[model samples]
Target: MSTVHIVGAGIAGLAAATWLLAAGRRVAIHESAGHAGGRCRSFFDETLDRTIDNGNHLLLSGNVAMMDYLRRIGAEDQLTGPSRAAFPFVDLSDGSRWTVEPNAGPIPWWILLSGRRIPGTSVFDHFSALNLATANADATVVEAVGGEGPLFRRFWEPLAVAVLNTPAETGAATLLWRVVRETFGRGATACLPLIAREGLSQTFIEPALTYLEANGAKIAFNRRLRAIEREGDAVTALDFGDVDVSLDSTDSIILAVPPAAATSLLPGIEAPLESHAIVNAHFRLEGAPAAVIGGMPFLGLVGGVAQWLFVRGDIVSITVSAADALAEESTERIAELTWADVAVALDLPASPIPPCRVVKERRATFAQTPAAEMRRPGPRSPLGNLFLAGDWTNTGLPATIEGAIRSGEAAACAVAT
Candidate 1:
């Protein structure tokens, strides 16, 4: 069996290795970081005396690839879901709430019937989104939903951020359309939203590693590939600092690091997209609400200090999606603004604000601008036995775990074939 060298032990790399190993290929994963789960890590906050994730991530029934990956790794049971076909939404401004039922299986019938919970939304909203199904493939989401009203702004804009990690104005319309069609428009089973009952590392990454190890896959921590040596069409070896690991001429390699690192390793590779930031604020509060926020685990904050709040026991975390605007702001300032938003949205009066942890990942995601769309590369590269895997690649979706998993699967399949 041919050996496969996977660079970066992120979710994508892990997924690829898992697949390749299952195919009876010898696999070795080299990671620069000492720990696994690159962006999806968690740590015990001693002050709070609880394990906290680096950030909050949600999975939708529409994310089939992710769900399948989870089940394969034996962590699918770690996810908790609300009753199928129901999503709750709360308006922090007025404390008014609504639930968007999943409707019937796969196809989103509720979208056509439920307008009261989704403020400013109407039956036309479904029609408008459906129209996008036939829109020009090259058009931006903003162009596809031209003049569709605040419903587009309220529901679509946040949805785009949650899906693509980019704003609707710059996000890919075709991707959004596909996401909606597959998850919301296809059937009711695709609409269930699953939240990680435990930390992401425990629920997804760790289980994946265990599965890989059980199958004889090796993961090398602190072994970063500084460069790739190629002979004509094939890669001969990878250069990690202080070591030169030779590879079989037929061995396959998957570069699953960030775009910045990819550009450096593959000098000729072009990444047209610039990186963006996401700011997440975690607060340790007393007496936090246990009831699921509206049926959805998360709520969109409009015209307020909190953009979106996720309630996890004593820890109340707020995520500011696509938060490039706050990149230059001080941590204190960002936390202050975010807490104020949470206060208003959660309707808390005079509650003591516990010590807050503000995480600002300046390069959390790639900027999904129009030009960036053109820069996204596919699984196959110019070099043979060398492929790319990451959410940043041309997975059609935004920089998400689902996209990462899909890209990894594609890369692994490419190598196997």
Candidate 2:
């Protein structure tokens, strides 16, 4: 039996191991962090006295890879969402509220209905998305879709930033169009928004670990890969700071670490070098449970520092994507600024802020711009026995759970062949 030495215990590595093990291959996972789930994990915050995810992510039903991974780990029921595709948004500047509700079929008849479309946007404005069909590699989100308009302000801009984690003015239009094609283009059934019912760890991590352990997969924490020893066209060994792992002819390697760490280990590897920041603020509601967003647990916000707000019980967590400037602010200041928006969006008093925990991920994701998209490498590497898996890899998708999981599956498939 050949043993596959997988580096990194994030979702990408876990997904790779899961697929390999299911194919009757031996697998071992090595992670630098003590725990799994990298940026998508949950932790107990003493300040809030609750378990909160390091980041907030929204998954659509169209994410087939993510759904398959969850099903493989027996966690298909761990997510919760509305029965229909409804995204409720609030404009803090004017206190106006609306919900973008797509119909059940592929035909977007919802756009014709004023109540289901973005407020003040004409039907022709909605059709402007067709402009992306002919967008070239150099086209940006603002270029493919008109930059200034009620539709751009209320729909395209927020969707681009949330999906790409970069400003829509320069973010790749092709990437955003790919997302639209997969989700919104498919129909309301595919665009249904879903979030972890309990926490990220419980839903995506713990169950995966359990499944892997039950199948005799080796999982080692704090075993960071510092260097790769190459002999001819194959990787001969992996060097950790304290130990080394020798690879035989049958043995293979899969690198599932971040782009920077992978670049450090394998110099000259093409990967997205630029990254953006994301700021997530979790606050514990004092008086009562958060007034849900149109009977949902999350709400989209515009004209505020925050972009998305998720309510889990008494905890209200807000996500600010492409928040390079906000990420530089002090935690106290971030909490204050986001809370003010949260107050208005949630219809709560703004004076005294509740117990809040601010988490700033400096390199949340690669800058999903036109140039950065060109830097993404595929699963197969120069070495015959080595492969790569991560959202940063060329999965033809943004750095999302679906993209990460798909990358891992692609690497595992490459290894099998």
Candidate 3:
């Protein structure tokens, strides 16, 4: 059997390896980094004396690809969140708090309920998002939603920025619409929030690596592909820094690196160039406050620097999506601003900030604009045996875990034939 060479052992590469391995194809994974889980891993923070994920990755029940991937690796139960589709939010502008809870059915009558909707939003305002579904290529979330009114400030704006990781003014409306169609449109059963109970590596990355290795797949760490040599319409060889690997006609190669790395390997690739940052402030606290609701442990915020706050035991983590400007600020300033939001949302006193670890993922995700989204290429390249896989690829979705997994599966399907 011809071995399938998978490059860049991130989630995309790992996912592709698993799919091919299940189909009885010989597999070999080569990673440039010394360790696995490129961006979605946990590390022990000495400052906080705890293990913290590099960034916050919240999953919804409607994320079918991620759920299927988790189940395949036998780690589906590793994630946990609130039992119901509930997202509690606080408006720092007016000191108003409310929980947006979706009902069991598709008809969103919950928005008509006073307490279930955003503080000042009406049912018509919630349903106004229907414009997003038919948004054209040039339409952004702002254009679709009008970028004003009570719903925009309280609900659409926050949800758009959080899920798209790009400002609503520039974020593609279709992408956000797809997310809403899958999650919110499907009702509460599909919109329940979820996150790794232990850590991301324990839930998503480590298990996939283990499953691939236990299935007799070969994995090589610290093996970076310096160049890929193509002859005519086929990729002939891959050159590592110290070693060169020649590919047989039957053998296939999957390049699952990031867009920047992939551009260097394959010349003139159509990949998303613009990227945004995601900033996280992980703070160590003594214990949970008395205001904790059913131990849900996370909250959404409006008119604040911190977009979302997540709590796990004694650690409280704050997430700011599309935070390119904030990422450039000093750590102390970021902590100070984030803690202010956390304090108000969690109902804690405005005490001095605790020991904090600020993490800035500069190239966390691609800027999901219509122009950038159009630049995303499919898995197949000019070289028949060489396939491309990444969240940045044309997966008909934003650069998300679900898109990454789907891209890998698409690459596997290409090589499987």
Candidate 4:
């Protein structure tokens, strides 16, 4: 009969509620936004006359936690990916194209095969990734992988930026290496590139809401957590602008909001404050862009303002991670520059940029620098009945869907015990 008052309706909160509700525990979700998914949701853009996600997100097959969450919501079939682990990349500066395909087994003998590896990279260069795996707390991606090399420029740097949302020169190496260990280290089976087949909301959010409601979980939108009243090491009440909900001794609370909101609500709590921005440009294309092997919907880009391209029907969306510099540019200018890269990568004409919608997620994620990584707090707080869950928590991984899901599960487990 214990009810859990969950704050926020993002993936973290939804994941937490889903787990608790499935256990026959009473659960309620409160969100400030009118809709769910926080930064991972999609909306209809009139300019493009199509639905587009606020940001482009991808998941590897190794994301076991997220896969399990999707299975719980009966959305396991809503994601699409390539049959194998292959990353097709194009260098706009020289028009050279290549796909880094890892072998089935873990040893990665594919590095010795010219046809399987990136051009100008040798086995010795491939082995340099070991530094990343063993990087210490103070080490950076550039420090672990070295500064100037074909492999570093073509592979490690982009992966670091995309995963960490921090510049390679200073991004924490441990995060990148953790990603490598979980996905690429497992084998080709675990590294298959996966993304939402329709949109992030449809695949990750809406279905979760549906499942939660069907299981007797109540969700309240626009009921933001204004404050938390504490009475001697326990959350006594939650203030939601117009009303305050008092909690009994057996009731528990899950703080699933962003780090800033958590810090504001709880005293003497430290969390990652430095954040990175991401820019996504969605263009209404005349037709689908060429796919990577096995009809993968996304392509990696180098030597351009954009980093990743996602093609859905007649829509082409560009994802620019670690986009602090680019996020400051005008929306029109970002569309123009991103179109140039998309045109080259997709082999399309560069004239008359199609109707484009630019989504700039300022503070998309915490800066994954060593200093910021040290600031991440764990789920347990001083209050006995309170627990925290978010990608920004000490999940021992970068801010990703997998990390967020894992964090929620961790909090739920902690609260249960």
The list of candidate 4 runs beyond 4 A from truth reads 292-294
Q: Per-residue lDDT for 1-417 in model 1, tens only?
A: 678899998889988988887778899889999988988778887767888888888778788888888888888898887766565555666666666666666655666665643766777665677656776766777778764575675677777776666777777777778777777776667778777897888887899889988999888898888888888988898999888889886788999999999999898776755877778888888765655565456766765555677877778888877788886888778778888777776666534566788877888888776578788899999998899999889888778888899999999999988
Instruction: Give me the candidate number with maximum lDDT.
Output: 2
RMSD of each: 2.1, 0.9, 1.2, 1.0
Go through the candidates in order and give each one's C-alpha lDDT.
0.79, 0.92, 0.89, 0.90
Q: Model 2 reaches what TM-score against the true structure?
A: 0.99
lDDT of 3 at 314: 86
In model 3, the Cα lDDT at residue 18 comes to 90
| TM-score list, all predictions | 0.93, 0.99, 0.98, 0.98
Superposed Cα deviation of residue 205, candidate 4 (Å): 0.6
> Compared to the true structure, candidate 4 yields what TM-score?
0.98
Look at candidate 3 and give me any clashing residue pairs. Answer: none
What ranking of all candidate models by TM-score puts the best one first? 2, 4, 3, 1
Error of 4 at 378 (Å): 1.1
Stretches of candidate 1 off by over 4 Å are 93-95, 111-117, 294-296
Ten-residue stretch with the least lDDT total in model 2: 286-295
